[model samples]
Target chain A: MELIDNVSVAKKANVYFDGKCISHSLTLADGTKKSVGVILPSTLTFNTGAPEIMELVAGECRITLKGESEAKAYKAGESFNVPGDSSFQIEVTDTLHYVCHFG
Target chain B: MELIDNVSVAKKANVYFDGKCISHSLTLADGTKKSVGVILPSTLTFNTGAPEIMELVAGECRITLKGESEAKAYKAGESFNVPGDSSFQIEVTDTLHYVCHFG
Candidate 1:
């Protein structure tokens, strides 16, 4: 497996996607291989309409699901599979971090 | 979306596999679909020699990687893609929980 760090991304993959700055560490977009990612300390503002599933790995994460009234709070280890086609903002609370879906 | 609580698992899944209790919440065993699961608080003593990777989702977790001198400690959000072959033990400390692989 290849090792990666935020530095690698901050130097190269710090770009804006759907209006949010995303540093693509590793992405398997072959449609055959699913995508796996680790959410870092970043604030994602609604840039486009794409629903996504997020799981809490560590720390506290605040996420506002599409068509939802209240924002879902996830603790470490907890997970939420989000649907694409919604707009929301993601904020990392207290250095919140998590491993993206990869099962 | 199907909501699952520990009670549902306690009433049903509580089996030992390779010397560990695994409550399969949702699994896509099809080669086309990757398997995804959330690890609960449990101790997995090496029943056989199957290598596996464990990521810390929440709380504190103690895991021993095959052929490693020291056990790797992971916090919530951090993830590890483990190989399925090296057998090991897993124990959740302080209600430690984790969202198993799902990408």
Candidate 2:
């Protein structure tokens, strides 16, 4: 879906990597927390505290999970799973719009 | 309040100025529309279509409304208004987090 209905959203944005990545925090009606964000064309590494499912809504990127050698390309309508307490390297060829589901 | 409760948020982000500014569109339960966004350190001009009241959540900037000579300094907890069909120039020294309330 293009929207998350009936949710509460934080006003302040979360800026990371000097603004290469930006996200807004969201809490669902049932208290489920999620984030919608964008990653500009750049290479960056992200660490996960909670297991995360990155759902791509737009753009493209190559992702390599921690301990993996091959970088797999993912685009809009695709998703990837990242284990908790792990990390991943991403090479974004296009600006990426994604919904991050934690835990 | 720190959050906008009981709203619907778009999954995709609105990326502008080559990613210098990023935002997510939100719709209140009653159908009022708004956006939460961030502006990195930069000087930029923005033209408004609907009359807007920009509420600052964090960071600082100097804003010069269209047809105005002086730029006013604004920071967190402050807000500024922009007329419809008009524009404004903004110089953000620190990273800025804002919520744009539109007509």
RMSD per model, one decimal? 14.6, 0.9
Q: Give the number of the best model, judged by DockQ.
A: 2
The Cα error of candidate 1 at residue A18, in Å, is 13
Q: lDDT per prediction?
A: 0.40, 0.95
Which portions of model 2 miss their true places by more than 4 Å? none
Error of 2 at B102 (Å): 0.7
lDDT of 2 by residue, A1-103 (tens): 4999998899998899999999999999888999999999999999999999999999999999999999999999999999999999999999999999988
In each prediction, how many residue pairs overlap at the backbone (N, C-alpha, C within less than 3 A)? 26, 0
Give the Cα error of residue A74 in candidate 1, in Å.
Answer: 0.5
How many collisions between residues are there in candidate 1? 26
Expressed as tens digits, the lDDT of each residue in A1-103 for candidate 1 is 1211111111012223321222122222232212223333566754333444454534566877657777777777677766555567677664433333333
DockQ-based CAPRI category assigned to the predicted complex of candidate 1: incorrect
lDDT of 1 by residue, B1-103 (tens): 1212111111112223421222222222242211122333566654333333444434566777556667766666566655554565566553333334433
TM-scores for candidates 1 onward, in order:
0.34, 0.98
lDDT of 2 at A59: 100
